[model samples]
Target: MAGYIKSPFNYTGGKYKLLDQIMPLFPERIDNFIDLFSGGCNVGINVDAHCKKFIDYNDKLIDLLNVFKNYDLNEILIEIEGTIAMYELSNTSTFGYEYYNSNSSGGLADYNREKYMNLRKYYNNIKDNYDKFHKNVILYILIIYGFNNQIRFNKKGEFNIPVGKRDFNNRIKNNLIQFINKIKSSNCEFINLNFREIEPDYYKNSFIYADPPYLITNASYNEQGGWDEDCEYELYDQLDILSSRGVKFALSNVIENKGAKNEILVKWIYSRNYNIHYIDKNYNNSNYQIKDRSKKTIEVLITNY
Candidate 1:
């Protein structure tokens, strides 16, 4: 875990913690590596491949990744620091909490609430016209200070998450630096598209890794019927197509969660005679908390070589 690069985004169901368990299972000599549901891109960024493609349905996220890939590290740091200074947001890394009369337990939320909202309003106002790099810088800054360090947008497509306790600290800054450096150097392309729309045959000698939203879990992406039974079935169908093309692929999902079994996933994998590699440890739950041992959660990596 210490050796792996972590994504700055605190994305739900991120594979950062599970990389040690997952990466070794991947093909040693991958010609092309495709991340089909690359939320936060924890897995893809760490994998070594000749070519990498990160595909996701979230256009905003893809845009942000592009910003990281296209901009210089110094430029990104400058923009982030400038935004923090401009918004009067707290920087506990530079100055301790005592500088703002706040403490770690309580956080700087009280002092940052009004300032954060103002910045959010300004970002929403110019989001359409602002420079792409600069606009995403604002969005990134917002997430740094936003609630739970999570990205959320309203129905109107506005940055709607409230101010969070944590700010852009030294640790987060370091993570961002590493992530940006990797993205800039890697032979990778980011695509915003539906997973099913990607043609499996196009990536003939490639390895695809799909970590779609788990059907049984409750997360922002899976809430409000975002992912349902039909979506699950459709994804399995796409994976089947990938198998037919002779593309080696790995899928990260849970067969059982909280005593609820994913019968559809179970039936599809077994019927197709796919390989199931059970994950010994239960990853984070819906709230990003570790699930208790009492809970029945069977996480697995279904692979087709």
Candidate 2:
């Protein structure tokens, strides 16, 4: 196995932590690899495959990924640094926190709040006119400084996350460089599409890996009925169709969380006799970290090999 390469985006529900447990279970040799519901692409980017396709419903995210795939690493970095200079955003990676009257524990949020807002406003305004590559460049920078390093948009289709406690430090820069290099070197494609629309039979000798929004978990994507019972059933239907076509697939989902159980998933998988590999997850201080462990949570990987 290759050394783990983390996704630069702090995406919610990412499988980065579980890669150690999950990747080893994947097929050793894959002809085509499809990362259905590829948020942040943590799993897809790390997989060794002849061809890789990252499919998602978020057009903006796909565009951003395309930017990473299509542009030169140095070009993207130059634009990012130029944007930072233009916005006068804090660069704690270069200047010490003491220079900004701040510290690592407190972060540079106080100094970057106003500047971040200005940058957000500028991005929202020029997003329509800016080229796809350059606009996504600004969007990437916004996400790096955005709250929790998340990519969020409002009902008006505007970037709405607030300034985070962190800045574009050296860690993020190095991660971005590696992510871009990985995308460029691999035979990868970014498609903005819903998982249901994909035709499983078209991808022969392929292995599909799905880490969709957990029906039982509460997250930003699952809020306001983003993913519901209907979506869950539809996904199951798609996976069944893939199985019928003899396509191998692995689905990562939580059947139980915080005292709530997904009876639908349990019934479906059991009835079909799918293989369920239990995942031992101890969420701590990370994004999906659960401080209260009083309630038992069960995560699993259901597969049709």
List clashing residue pairs in candidate 2: none
* Best candidate (score: TM-score): 2
Instruction: Give the least accurate 10-residue stretch of model 2, judged by summed lDDT.
Output: 285-294
Cα misplacement distance, residue 126 of candidate 1 (Å) = 2.6
True-structure lDDT of candidate 2 = 0.88
Model 2 agreement with the true structure over 1-305: per-residue lDDT tens digits:
25988899999988888899999899899889999999999999999998999999989899999989888899999999999989999888888788899998998788999999999998899846668877999999999998899987877889899999888899899888889899998999999998767776656678999999999888877776779999999999988988988999999999778778899999999999999998877765322246555366889999987
TM for every model, in the order presented, reads 0.93, 0.94
Model 2 ranges off by over 4 Å: 127-129, 285-294
| Per-model CA lDDT versus the true structure | 0.88, 0.88
Candidate 1 error regions (>4 Å): 282-294
Q: Check candidate 1 and list the clashing pairs.
A: none
